[model samples]
Target: MEHPLSQFKYCPKCGSKHFNINNEKSKQCADCGFVYYFNPSSATVALILNDKKELLVCRRAKDPAKGTLDLPGGFIDMNETGEEGVAREVLEETGLKVKEAIYQFTLPNIYVYSGFPVHTLDMFFLCQVEETSHISAMDDAADAFFIPLTEIRPEDFGLGSIRQGLVKFLSALK
Candidate 1:
């Protein structure tokens, strides 16, 4: 609801409001002459389904997607392979240890930092959680649970990422 950097009156380095909003996050500084573009990182996610055919979902607490439903995921850290990132993200966000990975697709997504070139690649997979018996919500999730596939709708999805993944996944099932 609020901009992450809305409180700054000046740049931390130069102390000037010479930077104007390119949309919500980006700025072109007329005074300090700096290119402070916030580029996005690659993110990976897994769509988990239990024996009951319910789909696992998480409520996001951080931005780029706060207060939305999402498959467990986050930034892909440096030196981490795409599979490694997906594995780590699932454990960090859902406390579920995933041992198997099936690369589904890689999507190039563009979103306005508020409305400006914040582009990121979102990688998705369908994973089988190894430790379902010990599953719990971890870092970024306010809550986590399994919802029946019929219950998943556009609003239940955090963004186009999960929705797109789910559509393909369900279609394949048919």
Candidate 2:
């Protein structure tokens, strides 16, 4: 896979072709003394467990791995914390208001969008719904359902980072 910032040929600030990679995570503009850092974007996912201990999962409705299983989450928007992002994504995708969310863990992921490798930091949260009986799939989720944690196969997740996170989540259960 190519670097996330490999598509950037010219400097955005100075509009010069002299922009060059200063290192793996940054670029420098020779003409205007401008430096750009390619930091990983932050994303959030919710691990909502019901009373039965079944975990909520969603099916993607769009590509970059559409039709694959995923946790209810999305990229964290500017000005929002990871916890807030998880709550918002959960409501948008599952239509369930988050009562509370606790920080679980974070994993680095490479999210390919439109064939561009955008790196991300996926922060997972353990949460519960205010109303479990009323869940309707919305937004980019084609469907959302709960499944036993033991039955979840990491390979079923199309996103490599998600699969890795699931494996860690399962291992922590022991």
Candidate 3:
């Protein structure tokens, strides 16, 4: 619990470690008067299925959870619709465009980012892309490939979160 990123720091008014996370959007120090609110990031991800029913996964190249296999997704820029975000993420992470996308699920997740408390409200969609088109990895990805859903395992994932998402998505299919 003693990490530089815990979001817990001296209130300056009265140094205290008692911080509350239940605040509507801000954490107020129980002692002094320090307010901290996480800036929740909005993200959109695309679950693309090919003709063989294989799902496309990308190996991440960035941090927070680097070197992991994940769905095509990224932060949603201001004023951007979920559709636009997902489409852009897919295009950016993989050199392929989704032809159609259908809403699937939403998840509110929190994780430590660079030792800072951060949260994410992720919107997911099932997408269909060109089946025979050449697949290639682009931004924020080291590589990508279409693999059978059953072949994905936690050990194969570079990040635990993406592995969990894949597991959940696969479970929903069953």
Leading candidate by lDDT: 2
lDDT by residue for model 3 (1-174), tens: 433335455454566767655455666787766786556688877888877788888887877678767778888999998888888888888878878878887787655667664577778889877653777788888888888877867567654455667777889899
Model 3 whole-model lDDT (C-alpha atoms): 0.74
Residue 113 lDDT in model 2?
A: 88
lDDT of 2 by residue, 1-174 (tens): 778777999999989999999998899999998999998899998999999888899999988799999989999999998889999999999999998999989999888888888889999899878977888899989999999988999888878888988898889988
Cα lDDT tens digits, model 1, 37-155, are: 55566888788889988888888776656788888876789999888988899998888888887898877765445544346788888888875666677798887888888887755
Q: Name the regions of candidate 2 deviating beyond 4 angstroms.
A: none
Q: What do the candidate models score in CA lDDT, each in turn?
A: 0.76, 0.90, 0.74
Least accurate stretch of 10 residues (summed lDDT) in model 1?
Answer: 1-10
The RMSD (Cα, Å) of candidate 2 is 1.1
TM-score of 2: 0.96
- Model 2 gets an lDDT of 0.90
Q: What TM-score fits each model?
A: 0.70, 0.96, 0.75
Of the candidates numbered 1 and 2, which has the greater TM-score value?
2
Indicate which candidate wins on TM-score: 2
- After best superposition, candidate 2 residue 129: deviation in angstroms? 1.5
